[model samples]
Target: MNGPRERGRPGGADAADRALDDAVALANGPATARPGSRQPSTDPLVVALGHEPAGAGPAQARTRARQRPDAVAWPEARRLARRVGRRLDPRALPLGEDLLGMALARSLTALTDLPSFDSSAMDGWAVAGSGPWRLKGQVLAGQQRSADALLGGHAVRIATGAVLPPGTTAVLRSEHGSTQLRTDGEWLHVLASHSAPRAGQEIRRKGQECRGGEELLPAGAVVTPAVLGLAAAAGYDELTVTMRPRVEILVLGDELLDQGPPRAGRVRDALGPMLPSWLRGLGAEVTSVRRLVDDAGTLHAAVAASTADLVVTTGGTASGPVDHVHPVLAQLGATLLVDGVAVRPGHPMLLAQLPAGGLLAGLPGNPLAAVSGVLTLVDPVLRTLAGRPAPAPYAAPLTANVPGHPVDTRLVPVVFDDESAARPLHFTGPAMLRGLAAADGMAVIPPGGARAGQETAVLDTGALAPAWGSGA
Candidate 1:
């Protein structure tokens, strides 16, 4: 009763007729169906030719791909981000007291030699002769007295850091000399046990630590509290350092609440409150944070108008109905330097070069995924822009086995236990932040995972102050 099947048609005339009717109905349906319904076609050829299944379209396919991203390897994503960051020009900032965490743009040179003048190293008597000596006036620190030459049997009481008078010989420490009243004013008698003083004992000579114009710190040195002290001691009133990379954060989502608890499908904006401080820790100066609704035009305008060196967009990176990042980037002629990263919890993340000479980092909606994007892309970009050297790769043995993705790298939060091994923490799902909050660092697990006792690279999270010289 049924006619022969047409080419590309699996069933007979009845099935073919039904398929054609279904295709026609789909062509006439809404351009974008409900969230749960099949997505519409993004490919014009598929719609024009009407060859796809009744409900399946290019848009649907794209959306599915986004849900499970076709990503590049994690290392490649980091390289791309670093390359883009290195292209940015380094800006010089005045080295003020607030320069902590900034990288030195150039080598810091000493303006004056340390211990610019010969000074006493302890509270002592500057003696010219070896035996009993006549006492002269005292020399206190900062007193600009004349450099009177001392006679063969003369001595002057000098305090630590006091400039040594001309023609002074060995110094007699206070405990090593006895003072007595004699006919010729007061006299200082060196005790027999301490009579012999080394030629330069108790004296700090000029330029002992560093000479004038010597390099105190090299370029790319991170300014720390001790660096500030050293700069001051080296007679430097200001420093020339690389400026922190300026960043703008665009928090996107219609279902995000600015404050209060999550209710009725709306969750509090976690990234908004957390990103600013985190970016600062990464050497970025966050300029502003704007919460945006899911509007393509608005996002486009925001991206085009941003003047910051980098713009970080949170959420809407996928190809879902509410996801508008890709289309906007396409319209603006931006280059997708990193389409996606082969890393768990943040596989949908992307990095793009905005047409306006700025870079854009797209973070996924999930809390943990956003953190992953920060470590994988934002950290490297900001570090490079700040003129900081790439952190040396270091690894720690794993105390327990960590599950890994078949093709992607896994960044699992871990705590260092008593055995000095990184122990993986649980509750590290893409949407959760509990594990990250309790973790010290993230263990980078390679493909196929690692067994217990395997050495894995640990990414510092700025969670705790690093041990002295351990570099985290």
Candidate 2:
């Protein structure tokens, strides 16, 4: 939830801003509700210092109402975030230990011809003509090329990957050719019924796989482990790759505790410990995670000082006494892009551009709501910046009917079963995390909801990627 509007805000809190917020809040429901509760038709609450009266858990989020005519539709919100990233500049880095999962900035052209030399593709004998052939010296991989050249009908013992001797026309695989020590010399002969070695058989011709300077992979390809191997095999000691988008996390809320159990009047800070790892999986270099109390000036300083490509913040999206996020944005003359999304529990989430540099993702304070924001907004943008391609969208039938949000789309945690159907889990309220912890994915239930056996879109979180870093 958000804190109160700070004093002397930009053009001063005129009647127009208040009227606009009220209309948008009324149109969307209350600016907020209890995190996990269903949307309620109610009037906006009078908040102070960014908090609601005594017992009402902080009002959900500030309604941006007409700021966007209405909150953006769920899918559109994602696309908007992606567009923001595409507009930003992409960084490039030389191949190194940190290149894993980064995207290719340019096509990976071969530094040298693949195979670079005519070489044996299998353990065989390099021969100039059909058998029976005279056999001479042996050739093994990694040895410098022998000065001797094979003559017509002459064969030499060779190993897989060995450079083919000059004048050799074809290779006879060891299994297909038999060698015998005759009275005068060694000779190799093909199998009794087997055919003769065809020209270029069992040989890897120079530049056959690719010519020097030929493109191996196009731009925007992710750098996977196999890609690294391929790059090394192609005689490349260096590669140009897309740099991971740098991100900084700003965790706001004075009532949140980072350690131990939630002490008197304080809940544990959940997002602070989770988002960094999650962001990395979605392709981001989380530069820092800073926890700040509900102070407008402090929040302003942090966001303004940040040099990262993205600045993700928790809470202060709603108009609560301490909800300072929006006010701070206005103070800095930032452009609000996706002011709010029409997703349950995360309707207050926002995306904006900083005046100086960087962008900010304002995630709702609720645990699960914040996660929804991360999925619907953060992932697409970060992946765009890092050059990671979006996963193919797929759907599965649901096991039950999920309640709808009238005008908003819903993302419910679900577990996929052998039937390839999604079993929607309970406890998936905007504020709840129990169902999500055990879920395979979040099912995107369209507005008006989906009935049992209906195919619903499933979102991938890319959680399978390794969470890497030095120990915290």
TM-score of each: 0.78, 0.77
RMSD of each: 18.7, 13.1
- Residue 193 lDDT (model 2): 71
Best by TM-score: 1
Q: lDDT per residue, candidate 2, 53-77, as tens digits? A: 1112222223233333568866668
Error of 2 at 201 (Å): 4.3
Residue runs of model 2 more than 4 Å from their true location after superposition: 1-69, 86-92, 146-149, 166-179, 189-201, 263-265, 467-472
What local lDDT score does residue 119 receive in model 2, on the 0 to 100 scale?
93
TM-score of 2: 0.77
Give the distance in Å from residue 183's predicted Cα in candidate 2 to where it truly belongs: 2.8
lDDT of each: 0.74, 0.74
Counted clashes in each candidate structure:
0, 22
lDDT of 1 by residue, 1-472 (tens): 1111122322342343233223222222222234554434533213323333223334533443455466766755776687686634545555465787777888988898898988888897987866588999888899976657888889899998899888787788999989999786999987878646767778888899889989988787778778889988887778877777889999999999987899999999999988888887777778999999999999999999999989999999998999999999999999999988878889999999887788999999899999999988888788677776554333456788777765566889988876557889999999999999988777777655677876555677643432111111
